[model samples]
Target: MPKVRIVDIEDRRFRVFSSPTVPGGREFVLVHGIGISHRLFSRLHRVLSAKHTVHTLDLPGFGGMPRPDSDPDIADMARDLAEVLERLGIGPVVAVGDSMGTQWVVELGAQRPDLVTHVVAIGPVADARHRTLFAQAAALGLDSLREPPSANARVLVEYARCGPRWYGRQVRHMIDYPLEQRAAELVPPLLVMRGGRDPIAGPEWSRAVARCAPRSRFVEVPGQPHLVQHTAPRPVAEAIEWFLAEVPQ
Candidate 1:
């Protein structure tokens, strides 16, 4: 079993689940969305770790980590992640993010392109169609109808652990982040993915995000919901592998 390692970055600390690096294999870093931890990517980690080194991160205030004095915005989180990667001496890895995780990945790609070779954002969040809290909630409610029971159970558990106050603060930061603008600044090869039936990140939003980056492609997992990475880990992993193969190292 992979154990958690605490990494200090200035005043803040992060909990990391790191696997040993494989010889001649690429390093992959997984980032989870708001109010959730690396647990969300356990299946994906298991699949990828077979052939490559995988590092799943639990940013501050999530995954049982102590909350900071105030909630850090998406860019703040990205900056801290960039610093963490630099201190860890891992570079040129494919950074994979899900939901609100996309904002962190995009900002990192823009801020520290040297650290990330390729980017994969699954079910990226805050579609322009639903900008406000109510609208986003509505979309989430609609999509919840399509998600699997296991996914719902896991989400509930994670949310309860996150608590209402912290989760609400994180949501505000997530929805307020200028994802598209920062995505356009990404220097790494970017791949945008979402579930075909995902109400939050629908076709239009996914296409728009893809267009933000010059070298980007949009792919969808058919018949899946917002938590497609969990529901269809194989396909998502396959897509990421294909993208990694195509991207120049």
Candidate 2:
């Protein structure tokens, strides 16, 4: 496992990632969800590292990366990610985002339509109203959503690195971000997939995202949870590989 590398892209500190992905392979950037860092996709990263140069980022305030106290919202994070990509000279690259990262995918694809060519989203929250759906998770008494494989141990540490106060603030921002209407506007060649047993995002939600974007396709994986990439990296990576290969030219 390669330790994450940090780079001062412009003024923001970015934890940049790059995998060999074969001698002469293409590159794709992986973006993680809230409270989770690049480590969320560790299993998938290792799997795909052989075929595609994989890149992940430790967005500000969420993975030991300095976050702006004032810009403590998804919009700000999106802008930061865009700058990170531009500064690193890594645009027009395939982007695979999960959950919160999916929100950034919408932001980046909409704002910088020319920058990101393809997007693969797993367990994505299509609309902000869906945020309320998470509260019900606690009600269901499901521990799976709270705990994942040890690979995500780093995510817990990264969230802790940001502290509870900041973490709560970010959650509040996400719950209040008014996402659905705007996300519907910027579809971009998207692949929205959900876990079959995912309490956070079920089939209806995935369908809504697919409907929101005519170009987007919705896939449902049976017997998986919120951590689709972690619980089943093979399927997630396979879906991503297929999407990348089938991307519209």
- Local accuracy of candidate 2 as per-residue lDDT tens digits, 17-129: 77754556666788888777877788888888878777877776677777655654667767777777787677676777887788777777777777777777787763433
| TM-score of each prediction | 0.96, 0.85
The lDDT for every candidate, in the order shown, is: 0.86, 0.70
Model 1 TM-score? 0.96
Error of 1 at 170 (Å): 1.6
Predicted structure with the largest TM-score when compared to the true one: 1
For the record, the alpha-carbon RMSD of candidate 2 to the native fold, in angstroms, is 2.9
Report lDDT (Cα) of residue 106, candidate 2: 72
- Write one digit per residue (lDDT tens) for candidate 1, span 119-149: 9999888899888989988998898799998
Ten contiguous residues with the weakest lDDT in model 2:
136-145
Give the poorly placed runs of model 1, Cα more than 4 Å off: none
